[model samples]
Target: MNEMQKPVIGFTCGDLNGIGLELILKTLGDHRLLEICTPVVFASNKSINFYRKSLPDINFNYASGKDFSRLNPKQVNIYPCWEEEVAITPGQLNETGGKYALISLKEAAQALKAGHIHGLVTAPIHKKNIQSADFNYSGHTPYLKDLFGVNDVVMFMVAENMRIGLVTEHVTVADVSKHITKESIISKLKIMHSSLQKDFGIDKPKIAVLGLNPHAGDEGLIGSEEENIIKPAIKEAKHNMLVFGPYSADAFFARGQYERFDAVLAMYHDQGLIPFKSLAIGEGVNFTAGLNAVRTSPDHGTAFDIAGKGKADHSSFMAATFECIEIIRLRFGYAEMRQNPLRKMSARILANAVDEKIEETE
Candidate 1:
């Protein structure tokens, strides 16, 4: 596709009772968004229409799954997953809606692999509700990893100036220590390095590796994981990647140390995400790294409390959508620094010849 041709982004219908449909509908309502990419929602026609009734001011068309081949940027393309009637009540959770959400996700993934879409920007999904429907997957990251057979996948949450990656996700605090290893840390670092330079357009990105214990174990006084596991992993990763860390988690985030690095590698979920969500709030974007296809989603969960109230903010969803576009451009060679539509009128890729030469000697 040419630069003028808008990229196609496939979206999954998140929990029907939640705010997924509302946010997707509200964001795509803006006609200007069509200028960047075609937003396609894989969902049931009835559910979308039901949500539409709640959002009366938004203007967009919905297409059925059987007619997916005829999609255009002129309307919100809907790949219907179900023909049955759905009783979608705002702010309420139902088991019936859970089944349809999974169906839509499966169809979206298949279409993405078939080259029908450039990338996927998913809405928030409730793991507990999906699990109640007999879905065994932990979350989207693990499911996508299994779908593409990608073992090196890592989840990075982007919040303005800070980006955080978890070496082990969706596990208990007790199990987190056992999951940490030199190999796992090294693998995540490599992916983070590649993603910063390739996807995020960072050149020679510096990464901070946070320690698992307090005060970085105080040189083996508080703990030895820093010296025995984290330090060694950082040293070994230097052969192929640039990484420096084993900093205390508490002080690292509190002192705003993350701003100094392109990305920070955290030991577990809450260790990295607590501070990230505090800063990013509604503007955070969750991106899956080390995958052949680019996938991103809102960092927050399905807000069942305010579902259907028309109170959900589209900022995070919009951020994810824009991030997907940049990833597609970089991956397909459409997003060179000079061609980026989001940048200044006469943007130029900075010439870093001096830094390259200096680094060669070091």
Candidate 2:
């Protein structure tokens, strides 16, 4: 595709001390990626140079700019967020690294809001170090939600075929139960249903909802979440989309039943993530659904142990980038289809008429 036709994807350099920069560099170094989308990294030259020196084998060509007025599709453009002299201690978590990570993220998010970039693929950030007066949020999902003024969003994880979305994210085990109410469940179902249809181009999405307790509370024998909360939510949601089950989480994945559905909605974090990561480790992409914008990130976190050693796997980061590009295209196509439903119906009828005429002539 031409440069104008391709979407410009903005990337944030998550925790400079971590493997964020390494993964970003490794993924963008492949020249073939440029053909699909324009990539702009929101980071500084000093940070990129630090990684380049650490790993001399990986060669990346990039353009440096303060703003994206003139973008070079041929090279990865580095939008300088900061240019200060800071310690570069890889694999060691410090406050300085967190500061830069937040800066990179804030700059990229601003650009995305202004329509300077089409989509965003954020690298992993250190949760503790990144916390500050400016960024008091728990993680990227909530931060993006508040940044764009979106009230509800789902933390949807995607692998090759297994797609999982969480009803409650970044909550403690004790708090998980309190959050699993009928209203919360129904809201998440709506988000997942819309995301599957629009972002994924699924005409009809089959979502398998997982139960909170063992064996789906043994049909209310073990717990009443299934009877009182989950069942009622699914009933209400069926009017909106094809939603089924509060299936037992254990048996659903063990029996390969999840493959039957387009996506799975788990009650909490570990319920869905444990199975997803176990199957798609190093390849999963975390996609934030039900937002006005498209944002994705690697399923994994900052590997502080192997940050500077150049041992970080870039597979998940690469997958996240590819997913972001694809979702953007899918959303555009879905919107176009929605805008001209009559045109599509008319074409379908014309095709049927042509087939009937051919049959008569034959």
Candidate 3:
């Protein structure tokens, strides 16, 4: 396919001090990806060359410019988020890194919002240093939620073995209970259902819900939230979806019960992530569900410990990019399928054909 034929994917370099740029360079350095989609790095050429020195084997070639209209289809492109060079101290978590990281993100977000980019794949960003009066979210999901003016979005973790969505993410344990409600649970279930069908192309997805308390509140002896809150939510969601749970988080994974369901919903962050990251290992990708725009990220934070050492793994970042491109394709296909004029007539046409065949056989 030609450059105009492939999807335009934008990458945000998260926390310049971390391994964000490293992963971007390593992942984009491959020549094969150019055939699938045109890759745009939302960082300056200087930053690219900074990390390029370490990985001497990987050929780093790209077109550098702020204009997305003239994007090179055959080679990587840079947005040059900043003109002046910024100090990049590897393994350091400081505002200096956060400053530039946020700039790249904002620029990329603007392009995405304006429809210049089809999808966004963000690297890891530090929650603390990146915080300001304007950006006050815990992470990307919440940040994008506010940017796009969505009421809520799901922090969905995807892997071959399991898919998990958090009811409450980046919330303190003390405040987790306050965040989850019957309505919230039902809302998350809807997002997962739609995402499975549209993003992953799994129709009629089966979802399992995990409880906030141990042993799923142990039949109300341990807690009442499961009985009073989660169960009711599940019951209501069952009206239109195949959802089951309020399962004990421990037994659910230990017994491999999640394998039966297409997706799993946990009451909070660690309840789902601990097992997902451990199981998915290095191949996991984080997908934001229930959003108008497609966004994905590596299922990892800034590896401050291994920053600039050329030791950071790019598998998850690569997976995120691939997932972003795929979702764009899936969403486009789903939209076309929904809007196809023949769709409404096809069901009746099939029924008549079946009836005619039955009559002929008889």
Candidate 2 — which residues are off by over 4 angstroms? 1-4, 342-362
| TM-score quality measure for candidate 2 | 0.93
Q: Residue 86 lDDT in model 1?
A: 76
- Tens-place lDDT digits, model 2, residues 172-203: 99999999999989989899989987899666
Q: What RMSD does model 2 have?
A: 5.9
Q: Given candidate 3, what's the lDDT at residue 105?
A: 93
The C-alpha TM-scores of every prediction are 0.90, 0.93, 0.93
What lDDT, from 0 to 1, does candidate 3 have?
Answer: 0.87
Residue 81's lDDT in candidate 1: 70
lDDT tens digits by residue: candidate 1, 1-362: 56577788999978888899998998888878887887789887778888888789998675555554677776678877778887786676777557767888888888877778889998877777777433677799988888888778899999778899999999988888898999999989999998887788676777889999888888889878888999999999888766777888888878877777779999999989998988653488999998888899988888989999888988889899988988888766525544575552332235244233212110
